[model samples]
Target: MDGKVIFIGGGPGDPELLTLKAYNVIKKADVIIYAGSLVNRDVLNCAKNDSIIKNSASMNLDEILDLMEKSVKNGKLVARVHTGDPAIYGAIGEQIEGLKEKKISFEIIPGVSSFFAAAAALETELTLPEVSQTVIITRPEGRTPKPSAEAISKLAKHQATMCIFLGVQMIEDVVNDLLTHYKPETPAAVVQKASWPDEKIVKGTLNNISNKVHEAGITKTAMIVVGDVLDTEGITPSKLYDKEFTHEYRKGQLN
Candidate 1:
């Protein structure tokens, strides 16, 4: 190949959310391939005027690789963009494997995930001193099969905070699976089109989140976060900034 391919995480939906590195890559790219159905079109505004841009939504895996291989062979810099952090459920693994077989060099650039944007939208932390210290990111099985051990019901037993991706359309089933271990009163939330102009959030308990999400008409392109982390009531304050806490930085103030 004459050039390299760069896989970029385009962030949630806001063009401003693009990292400086991602912005520069888009600006310098000679070709851009992106997920059209899920990615925000505005993110492409930074692309070079003469850049070759293609939407991968209608293309098969082989087609995507073919384009990348061709572009790289032509001595052109190609940008492969995906919404949110490309590492999480971004399906980059298969592409990486294909690249390896073809010996096409590439690099990955991480971006702000929708779960983080969802937390920002809710103005809450996913982890707290006395609340959940774990954030389990998974998706309920759909056409994409998941390991039996990683079932939503099994993950719920940890009582850790959860960031479910691509499961909003099946909210009822997800709630049912979560109910197997999580309390019905446990807080749950859904953030749709996070960071976008029409972003919407649905907050409630597991007992009612399914109905609430349906009522809000959020079917897809959303994040489902659940656990005690969503509830900040009576949580112990973090000790990092507490005067009573001691660390390598300072001594505890004790009289």
Candidate 2:
């Protein structure tokens, strides 16, 4: 009689960005479980009146699994909420594997990542045709092992716009690795506590990014972005905005 478990992405810290589907599921969930340290608590308002809300921050893996098992065995709808997109370093793999061993059906719901929201908060585009055409989302290896191919230094060679998560504490290392390929003057920005009312942004270059980050005393809950995409100073007009350029969305008319 156990019901399904739905893992929902809480989408940065802004409650407004949660998808309609995610909201609907939360509203109907009989058991709402969320990552308390990262997710905004205001999101709990969407849950059903009788729903049992639990914060998983204080619980260990076994404890969390036990809660889920009990909920499902009671034929209750469970919503497992995570901050940002659940797929990225959300630590859901181990949990999902455990669920499989217990024969519990589950579904993952995706949400906008913090990197996208950080870029949006700055009103900047990560990909520019010539300036930079690629976006790399990565993190500096901490306790987790990063593949050699995806190492920060190697990925820097492309000079693609880079968004690094869970690596703010190692900003010095990040700056040094990026310098292996990118110029010292390559524009970079750090968004701290992005999308939240107290969000702060520190903009600089590869040379000074680490220093600026340190100056701000921001050690976590921040995203480090690098490349010309953050270069608001030397912006060239986009072809889409050029009147002489024609496109299906806005064709050029005879002058």
Candidate No. with top TM-score: 1
lDDT of 1 by residue, 1-255 (tens): 579999999999999999999999999999999989888989999898999999999999999999999999999999999999999988899999999999999999999899999999988899988787889999999999999999999988998999999999999999999999999999999999999999999999999999999999999999999988788778788899889889999899986
Best by lDDT: 1
What ranges in model 1 sit over 4 Å off? none
TM-score of 2: 0.92
Q: What stretches of model 2 exceed 4 Å from their correct place? A: 233-255
Worst 10 residues of 1 by lDDT: 227-236
* Per-residue C-alpha lDDT of model 2 across residues 1-255, encoded as one tens digit per residue: 658899999989889988888999999999998999999887668887899999999989898888888889989899999998999879999999999999988999998789989999888988876788789999998998989999999999998999999888999998888899999999889998788888999998888889999999999999999988887666676888788789989876566
Q: What is the lDDT for 13 in model 2?
A: 86
Please give me the total number of clashing residue pairs in predicted model 2. Answer: 0
